[model samples]
Target: LHHLKTKRTEVYQDSSPFMSYSGCCCVLLPYSKCCYVLLPYSYRCYVLLTYSYLCYVLLSYSYRCYVLLSYSHFCYVLLSYSDCCY
Candidate 1:
């Protein structure tokens, strides 16, 4: 709980206890079902969430670039590559 609280504080800029608990589960729980068979449930959730979150952030950034640089298709390609390959 303490660790999740701190992580929530750092990542989300919110220190509320409720936010900590909810954030922990929101950040971890969904992957539980899909990745459960891959690694220990907890570790797998952590890894999957981290990867998916980072990938999402990058893909969003690339999409923004695509919109801004619509004159070039490269950004769209990059977005597709990130979504498909990451």
Candidate 2:
């Protein structure tokens, strides 16, 4: 885990260890779930969203202004059209 100045935060990456990503996952958060969401690394980068060792979704840049997202296995919508989470 990456330590901040004082507070301890969990270390998570957008890309999966077994899969691949290809879009800007301006990750907001899952609705009514206890999961972590990270900001997009770049405007055109890949991010693999996961939880509990389960690959939730594979992010990829579809278009210049397309908000591509995926629902979780439990029917959880982890992302939205506005992942511009700062």
Candidate 3:
């Protein structure tokens, strides 16, 4: 029992700093068959997910702007041609 307690304390001491740095809450779940370390929603995970989403949004907006600009330029050229022909 003493050895098991010491081992658990060591695990917490080793994992706490790393978990805190990443803004995660670490939980030790002991089941009848096994033990698992659960890390709930870390800031690093959120940042990575959000970064991809942000990149996607920026790319979509940039493509939209490029298309709108092309359309506007095409309309301008048509107007200029009509004026010249008239």
How do the residues 1-86 of candidate 1 rate in per-residue lDDT, one tens digit apiece? 11121123233324422222212222223223211111123321122223222222222232221111122333222222211111
**Runs with alpha carbons beyond 4 Å of true place in candidate 2:** 1-52, 61-73, 83-86
Candidate 2 lDDT over residue span 1-86, tens digit each: 11112121233454355222234333323442223333355433333434555534423243112332333534334344443333
lDDT of 3 by residue, 49-72 (tens): 122212211111211211111222
Q: lDDT score, residue 6, model 3?
A: 13
lDDT of each: 0.22, 0.34, 0.19
Say which prediction, candidate 1 or candidate 3, comes out ahead on TM-score. Answer: 3
Clash total of candidate 3 = 0
Go through the candidates in order and give the clash count of each: 0, 5, 0
Screening candidate 2 with a backbone cut-off below 3 angstroms (N, C-alpha, C), the clashing residue pairs are 14-48, 21-46, 22-46, 22-60, 26-83
- TM-score top scorer: 2
Model 2, global lDDT: 0.34
Find the candidate with the highest lDDT and give its number.
Answer: 2
TM-scores for candidates 1 onward, in order? 0.12, 0.21, 0.14
Badly placed stretches (over 4 Å) of model 1 are 1-47, 52-57, 61-77, 81-86
